[model samples]
Target: MVNSVNKRGEKILIGPRLRRLRTSLGLTQTRMAEDLGISGSYLNLMERNQRAVSAKVLLRLSETYDINLSALTSGTDQQLVGELFEALRDPALGRDRVPKSEVEDVVGASPATARALVNLHQRYTELSRRLVREEGADEAASALQGTVPATDLVRDVLQRARNYFDPLDRAAEDLHTELELRRTEPLTALIARMKDHHNTVVRILPNDVMVDMLRYYDRHSGRLNLSELLPASSRRFQIAFQIGMLEQRSVIDTIVERADLPTIDAKRLLRTTLANYFAAALLMPYGPFLKAAEALRYDIDALAHRFGSSAEQVAHRLTTLSRPEARGVPMFFVRIDIAGNLSKRFSQGRFVFPRFGGVCPRWAIHEAFASPDKPLVQSVEMPDGETYLTVARRVTRSGGTSSAPSQSFAIGLGCDMTHAKRLVYSDWLSGNPMPIGPNCYLCEREACPQRAHPPLGRALAHDERARGLSQFAFAPDH
Candidate 1:
């Protein structure tokens, strides 16, 4: 039964995953079947999706090949499928209509080819933007020669690792324990450690003195200056971040090296990201934080208060609790600005954010802008019928001056609905979940007044004699 249906009560089909695993292990159908004590014909049928993988077969596969059951059943392929579909839907491609089922089939059959196509499309899009912005032929030719953007490369690295760096986590935890952060205030302990270990003096400067920089480490003066604009939580985080840069440089560099990134900019960005991860781990050590989260029923405010972190920090940290031995609920986190741009995203779960465009307007994350600083909860069902419990709230970053206005963004955190009962926010869940899509260009939801663009590959259905709730209508059946 476990292999028969996923948490959403839908029949699970892991043919691609099973075949990929077998291929990775260098096992033929007969060999793997022998290992699992199943007939070769049965294995072939399972690999071809002609037969459902029984629980016994799943357990046998896990026991024999040493695979995580979640890895086999998770919706990881959906991200690749969605990205490939979006890439093929590009107007510039000028290809005939490609159905989503065909896209999924392509991913299932040959994920490597699908990923290559998606990567090519990304490069093409980046080059196209550069061509639009710059008129010079030399500049346009240089743009065409550019590889994937540094940001995208760094994001791909993080996503591939599932945002969890075990070595960094363990190192930060060890440091936290050695410093006895539990006995004293985190900021004070961090400051003492910085002064004692690194001979760095932590200072808070006035807004005028710091000006635009939130944090600046003066190497010659041995002073780490933090802007007065930062709150207590931010100051602690910045101090920890500096400590990480000094202490964890080797470990961060090793990780970046192993990632085999293409450009210097990508390496630098990844190093900073890893340092931020180390900082969060130092503030909220994995063991204590995971325990407190469970005790508080995954309450964001409670966890933030307990760890002396901000809501956004707490949400980001939640996505990194993917330790094999002591795992927390798998979750996804995203940050969106008022203009509907996704500034940040990380997932240790099945949910995938749209790669190129804005998110679905119906998502509660957008509604959080209306009631800033207050948390909003909703149960949302994607077009694939997978449901998730999402929590969204507005977080503000102060500029500390009238001339420099503050910036506000919506922070979204979500997990599969199956894990919703473990969260305190589940109390707000409604029986009817809001139906949403990845984005307007990919969504086929009809009569949505919030629909900003007609779905790609679907012909617009215009009739002067009739009007509907949506301004741009399309054939849903298409």
Candidate 2:
């Protein structure tokens, strides 16, 4: 727990968190300053975290807004410190020899730079891992060899765009307000808007008529058609997405243009992705959703019920709560099929998604299949020594008929352990954390019994007389 004041009677600095809380409540610095009986400049400095909030101001903040004091003052700085420590340990960085005080100074004085360095290190790790894996494989032998899949390329484009588009988020928020969605049923309101503003009618077509098509818009008839195979939530989502394409096309296009994707397919995919993102933002307004998430302790089922969404949708939305002004917990989300193929992934944390192949089988996401619908929670430590709290569950997609094929995928959501206590799933955690890695070939764990391949660039020692705990033993790098 953070103290209200330091031993020297100095106020605790919580500028960034204070700013986030104020912004989440839509309060300006001047108004918040007046409410706290302080000067606007002082409030500004506090918001920037340049100065600490005095005990009096802290009490006033808690009383006035019902702020979660502990949440407002914790986790972020510690997370930065941990990431910096991990990044400095990269063999390529050679920063292990540098004094720790200098690294701490860098983290304190310029956090953005520290974060950038961490991102660079992750990219280095990912690219190095990829190159090493492809060293000897023929182009035909590897699908990822000569050409990057448009999916991977599109993912990189979105990552470079930081997974948050200000214009699109703002547009969605504006639509939410314009439709007066808060007071009424969002689906009904959106339907009325589609009929009134876009002169388009939504029709849910039977499976026979649509036949494998989930959604299609007939421009000539000004009609939006959706297959009945989709559930009610997916139906509403498709309608909302159509609204995004029809109304927020300019915003989506502008963002896509700015992305400067390398190919036409990538651009098209990005446009569709941005439209879907806008739809989700419209469905779950940022400020309200974030407030509800904190108030509900990030209960996924509760959030889904409150927002009239599905569990997977809520999980995906949690990863997008990086609006800067009203940020939520930084999280990483991934969806994978039973065969261990990554269908989708996004990260707002320091988590590294596996880029080369199937993830390590030791991950709990795979184990989640045993119970089918129930969520399995785990505390896992990465090879780099950072711990994360993760929850995984299976989501089933029905084919709307016994003959049609049904698909099931596991969705995983996690965040840094520093923030885990705030989640309901944390209560179920016990015992030591499990050790895991992104992928086998790239992981350098010395004695992992599950390792499938030796790490690249390490020399293997073959001795008839000796055996070790691990199947692969390596000579020390000189």
Candidate 3:
């Protein structure tokens, strides 16, 4: 039996989790207690958090119910707490500061209610944005048309799945073995597989012919056209992605069907996203990749070279390493353009990304643009006091020409401080972490020199006589 204390030595409180599990199984406290060889009163006390769940009880619960221990102690609660913290920071709430302890209490008692509150806030935010865009449009119209964007819907779906798709990973691993990708060059092998299995001819087209497109498939001609500009890694990924579309359609469809998305556009977008996931898995099989990542201390460049992939591909793949038995470090990844527009974001842990607006300017991701191509490491602490080790670097897209320059984007990869020591970048940790928050609106940190906006729900303290380093200053009490 594993002890109730987590790795950090914090006592695990399973009250809410225990109650939820019992309710989910439709078992009464008395019945569950009898099954676990415990008294009903003791069970009630455990559910109410009046007592800590014992190691023996945990063992019995697992043995009796076939429960995974980690499921009860996972960081899902922390993720919810983070989301709720951000949601309550919205100015529209018009409420004074709600203590973080109260928020945790609510989550501990009823996580579902906390999640519903977050969802309600998200819907309200979307409707508010629509109203602004429409300029005093009818409330009914704003409410009706303010559905979540397909991209956001897809992001939520991926987040709920922890960015790992077991079906896709298994299928990709099987295909990788069948193709003997370990022994053969991946690009040539994948191209040959496309030709042999799908009867699709692969052709590399000139810059003038292909134009701006990197990869184009002509279904009528049964030909896959790749631009001459794409590097070997990208060409391989494109081919593998095409193969996923053709071969893994059923698996992808099953996953999408299970998703039960509201819009066809979202479903289509999810299909494309899943295909991309499959391509990444094909390029770097899960078991082997996890082993190699551990061995290499998650050096993105080293993994890219070893797996015949780009640095971006390798970084993105790191977020999907969430296998229960052979899991790698749980990390969050985000990609942003030079203008600070976030293009891609994923988290396999408790780190929460802002649903609306730019991230905090103090984050190291923004600093990556200054030293292009050089990786910068920083230990950052969130407003909630959670520390993370962030590694940021700039990566350029392929197909750049003298006439048209390729775009460069910053990639940010980070893991919780608890797991930071496993990363090679942790050597740069100085113990003194830079304070960051979700964004300017949600962040309450005072005197942030890089703050772009005043914190939501806080009154600005403006004085002509004296000015602080930041453009906006708020009341200390606020």
Candidate 4:
């Protein structure tokens, strides 16, 4: 579909977006204007939506910041539109429904106001949830309940930073350059580097001795031990992760310091998280990886084979392809266990994960486990109206021996509908996307047969005369 062109032949004015990008990078209006070859007053007008951004200025912004121009402007509205739709469906809104056209007009004409509306909706939803919970809690317990979940805090830290740490990316890139990680035998190179530089010998030990551990380092003996059960790709990753811990300590420490994490455990987790990211970046250098992904149409298995990495590693790396100039399709990568516990999540796209409950069972992430090792692709629409094309596969951790325990989880990689055509999996999909929700508590879908709980702010109604598909039927707010 062609984007609508303005009188100046510019494709829509994303003024709030330009302002956001400039502020995100801590750039002044004057500095941004100078960079874009425009006067400060003109830039101000553009930022306020009084003046549309020309194609030339858009090109300059894209080239200068290494940003995905389409994503900056066009991809900004789906989430807002979705949230607005959800808000309008609230019982408090009564039977008078707000039209989708009005929502679209609000998003297009004044995106800042639309964003503020979304924020207010989110706050109202959250406050309603808390109010409901507090009604049942004692004074002291209710006070304690206000503390944020550690997962929520970590998520916020990653989200606010857009899941891309420039310093870490630069460090990984520099390390890749210095080590020449894109060689015919990159794993061998990494092993040699570990041995020669870090004085750490990488050993693959059998499962019996290394029980209950995937990878462990004996600091005193200068040995990094790995389980024999691990596949070749995992073995290589463990080695590189150890290298990151040893060599990239300062970089990881600096990042953790900058995060101002709440607790020691959060710091430790962030450190490990940074190391894992560094390992992925090292294995798949951004430029070559991005090129191969585009060439292969982002076939996860193909890219994994080309890069000599695991499917999970490749999927996770895809989410990190947020470098300004060389961005890939914005994606959300999540790993959920069979029991529906989210172990890992990162999104350049705006797929919201539930903070306080299980993910909606309707999501393919949970179903992927039924056909272990097989990839299942689906087009899913959230209750609010945003759609995504998601690919999910179950990954297993070996226990070396058949009798030993193995852990399994499903990894999901998804991009918004606009980018789905680029993926090979989309060929089999047809019709509208399956309607799903972020979670039961946060979901306001009144008729979802799979809903496990009533949505926040919507009170449950007792009806002897009628039974609905959902167990927790809600009545309109009085």
Q: Using TM-score as the measure, which candidate wins?
A: 3
| Order of quality (lDDT) | 3, 1, 2, 4
lDDT of each model, Cα atoms only?
0.84, 0.79, 0.86, 0.79
Better of 1 and 4 by TM-score: 1
Residue-by-residue lDDT tens digits, candidate 1, 1-478: 4557777887767788899899999989999999999899999988888888888988887788788898887664899999999998774554377999999888877789899999999877755643523212345434432344567667767777777899999999999999898998888998998899988899999988987889999888889998889999999999889989999999999999998876788899999999999999999999999999999999999999999998889999999988889999999888999999988977545476755578888999998989986799999998779999999999988555687678989999999999999999999877799998877766768688889888655788797999899898776562
Q: How many clashes show up in model 3?
A: 0
> How many clashing pairs per prediction, in order?
0, 0, 0, 3
Regions of model 2 farther than 4 Å from truth: 1-146
- How far is 103's C-alpha from truth in model 3 (Å)? 43
Backbone clash total, candidate 2:
0
Worst 10 residues of 4 by lDDT: 132-141
Clashing pairs in 4: 66-324, 66-325, 67-324
- 344-463, model 2: which lDDT tens digit per residue? 987545677755666777789998777786899999988889999999999877455888777888999999999998888999999998998877766788688888888766788877
Ranked candidates (TM-score, high to low): 3, 1, 2, 4
What does candidate 4's lDDT look like per residue over 1-478, in tens digits? 3334654566677887788799989999999989989899999998888887777887888889999877666644777888887887775454588898888767776678888887897786687455433212234223433344455446556766667777777777788888887655877888888889978888888878887888999889989899888888988888889888988899889888987865666678778888988888888878888899988989999999998988888988888888889888888878888888887776555577655566778878888888885788889998668899999999876564666556888998899999988888888687778898878887788889998888876877889998888887888877
Which candidate's lDDT is highest?
3
Q: 1 or 3: which has the higher TM-score?
A: 3
With candidate 4 superimposed using the best TM-score fit, by how many Å does residue 221's alpha carbon deviate from the native? 2.2
Question: Residue pairs in steric clash, candidate 1?
Answer: none
